[model samples]
Structures are given as structure tokens and as C-alpha cells.
Target: MDSSDFTCVDVRRDGFVLHVVLDNPRSDMNAIDRAMHDDLTKLFRMLKQESQARVVLLSGRGRAFSVGGDFEWFRTLRSPHALAELNRDAKQLIWDMLDVEIPIVTAVHGYAMGLGTSIALYSDVIFMAESAKIADPHVKAGIVAGDGGVVAWPMAVGPARAKEFLMTGDALTAAAAERLGLVNHVVPDAELEERALAFARRLAEGAPMAVRFTKMAVNKLVKQALGVAFDASTGYELLTFMSEDHVEAVDAFLEKRQPRFTGR
Candidate 1:
């Protein structure tokens, strides 16, 4: 495995399968920071160049899969321009994850919140632990659910459920999410990775063209139904990053307290 400043992303190959683990540790959950984002972008680019890579299994290294955007990373940015750049970086990461050509399966456990939830949702298939919690808490942080939520949620679970989740900033249990069609399956925590890898290997063993084409066909339909909403989400999320409320939200989270947002 190679290393970067954000060695948070660890990549390894076994036969035809690529195993990628998110390894950030500041939070029990691996919250995405700029460095980690860059690493993931690089990882995907490498994957895109690999004609022999048949499957990808994405998982987190710690107790929680991911807790979303890094609070400390947000706290360090004080300018509208800087915030916009950060948002774009994050948006691009999600878009790459969605548009990548290979068959990808995500194994989620513990917390999958904010952008983390979006990552899981965008995967070709998601296997989550029953103990996992997935939430789009961007509204709670005074930002739009821009990263993956608005682009993917309504398509996966219907517009009404999408509205409720984004509006309320509530966490959904893995079982609830599966029942609502947001996740593919919910298994025991111990079984999450095993199940996901097994599924990925199965896909990898199949005819590559058939699997890739089927995934592409379905994704095209989703993108068409969703229109250019992803572009809109990118703009809105960056705009919110310019807000005083956004900074305050990050500060509050880092300080371990409720944010007293002034809606600036």
C-alpha cells in the first residue's frame, strides 16, 4: 500500500479486487478532510486506469465508516473563496465516486453521516451493519445536503422521503434505510465487510462488460431523472460554506456543543 499526507485512504489489491479503506482517525468516524479527499480522487483515477480491476470494496478502518466532512478542516477556512474551493473539492470527489466505471460496493458500519452517507448511497451496492447510522445532517450544520444527498436520495427513495430526510436532518438506521430502499442490505456488524467483499468478488468474477454496461445503463437513467441537480447542489453547498453560520456550525461541532446559529 502507498502513503500520502492523508494516508487515510489505503488501497490494496487481491486477485482482481481492490480493497480501499478510509483510515482517518481524528474522529472515531473517518470524517473527510481536504487531504483525504485528494487521496480518494487519486485512488479513483488509478482505478480508472486499471483495465484489470474488476471490483472495488470500500470500507472504513475504525468503528465508524465516516462521520462526514471534517469539522477542523472547516474551522481553518475563513474566506468565502476558500470555502467555495473546499466545497468544489468535496463535490468533485462525490461526482467521481458516482461516475467511476468499475463495480464498487461500500461496507458501512457505525456512523455514515453527512457526505459519508452520500458516499454509501452512490455505491453500486451498499452493505451496512444493522448498528450503522446514516444521516444527511447538512441542514443541521446550516448547509444544504449538497455532496450526495440532493443528487442521489430522491432517485433512490422517492422525493417525499428525500424531502423529509434533508429537511429534518434525522439519522436513519441501516434496517430502516434498507427497508426504504436506500441501502441494499443490513447485516450484523461483524458480517458487513464479509458480505460486501463477497458480493464484490461475485461481480468481479462475472463478465466485466456485462456488469459495467448494466451499471452504466442504470446510472444514466438516474442522472437523467435527476437532471443537472448535482451542479445546482455544488453551487448551493459552496454558497452555504460562505455563511457565518457554516463556520459557527463547524466550531460548535469541534467544541462539542450545540451551535447558536445567527443565520448570517
Candidate 2:
């Protein structure tokens, strides 16, 4: 397949392993968009065929892991239909990540914010860089973190901490993330990729059927909970986009200043 097929993800074969890198080479911060969401669908569909694909590694080139949704795209979605379509696409993208039978290891470095944090959470194992800053700042953008944040955070950490982080949109250091069980391990930036690959290879060596079944069994409860919450919160998140707070948040981001959000 041509590399150009995916604008947000880089696909490659690495000796029985399929390496998918999130490479927006020109953009230091790769942001999620419609194209990326479509790319994710294609990538996961292809993954189903690669039975030999024992492990999948997700990473990003340049400074950031991801910066979440694209600003231009968000600005374009003003109407109810556009917003609903956007949410539907996004929900499918996240579902693909959650349902991928193969093991995934996200090697995160530098900044991982907004949907970036959701991407990491979807992975079976997330290895973070010592200097990485991870946060779900969707609320800062005036959207409820209805995706993986609401579905996964409380399960990963405690509900109290999840509330604090999701509500405040505060960034967490790698060390703090480790304490909260947000990531599997923290490595020096230089060793982040190496460690993640090593761990993935270890899982790959195990019995595939047993591993897949075990994963599904363990996640049954989580799957049920996510199904209910993701549906309900989808509307809540889209409603926020219609509010003035979302407009102000986007404006502040463009203006390069703090947003003074009023609970309107």
C-alpha cells in the first residue's frame, strides 16, 4: 500500500511486525482530523488480515505524540449535522483502537494532550518518556472528554483523580502519571522506543489465542461500561461545541493566551 494513503499515520512492515507511526513530518504537532479518523479505519481493517502481526507499535515523529483535533476542522463544524457526523467518525476511530485484537504499545514522548491522551489510553500498554506531559484538555477546548477520557480514566486511575484531571485539563508529569497508574512505565526519552518495542516483542512471543481471549475476557466489564457512557457523553460533548465557551476557547488558542471560560 502507498504511504500517502494515510495522512496522519505512517504504515510499515518490520519483520512480522506492522509499525504504524503517527508522522505529520511538517507539523511539529500532529492533530487529529477527518482524514486521520478515516485512516485509522483503514489501518485497523488491514490489521485484521495480518494474522502474523503479533504486535503493533504506535508512535509519533517530531516533538509531539499528538495535539488532538485539528483547529480548522473544529472551526468548520458549526451546524448540528456537521457536529454529529464528526462525532460518529470519531467514535468509530476510538472503537477501532479499543477493539484491535492485537497488542498495542504506545511510545509517547514530549507532549500528549487532548485526544492524544485518549490514544495512549486505548493502547494495551503505554510507555512514556520521562519528560512527556500528558493531559486530556478537551474541557479546556470547551468539550466534555466524552471519548476515552470519561470511559477509561476513572477505570485506570481513581474517579476522584479522573474528575480533577478531566475538569481542570491539567498536565501530568511522567512521574506523576506512573504514580496514578496512567502508564505502564517511564523511560528516558532516548530509550522510550527501545523499551516499548522490547515489551511488545515479549507479548508477541506468547500464545496468540490465549492472549487475545484473555484480553477480551478482562475487558468485558469495561466494554459494557464504555458502550453506555460513550453514547450518552457523545451528545454532551457536541452540545459544548455550540456554546460560547468553545468559541472562546478556540479564540484563546488562536490568540495565544489563556481562555477566560464562563460557565454559560
- CA lDDT, every model vs. true structure: 0.81, 0.82
Model number with the top TM-score = 2
Quote the positional error of residue 180 for candidate 2 in Å: 0.7
- Candidate 1, position 82, lDDT: 81
lDDT of 1 by residue, 1-264 (tens): 344424678777878888888887555678878777677766765666667678889999887889888877876666877866766676667656656788899999989998788878878999989899898999888888877688678888899999999988999988899999999999998888888888999999999989988987887876665457877776787788778898888778778999998979
Give per-residue CA lDDT, model 2, range 1-264, as digits (tens): 436677768878676456788876446787776677567667766665567677888898888898777776788888899988878877876777667788788999988887778888877889999999899999889989977789778888988999999999999999999999999899999999899988888888899888877776766777787887887777899899898899889888988999998987
Choose the strongest candidate by lDDT.
Answer: 2
Question: In candidate 2, where is summed lDDT lowest over 10 consecutive residues?
Answer: 41-50
Clashing pairs in 2: none
Model 1 Cα displacement at 191 (Å)? 1.2
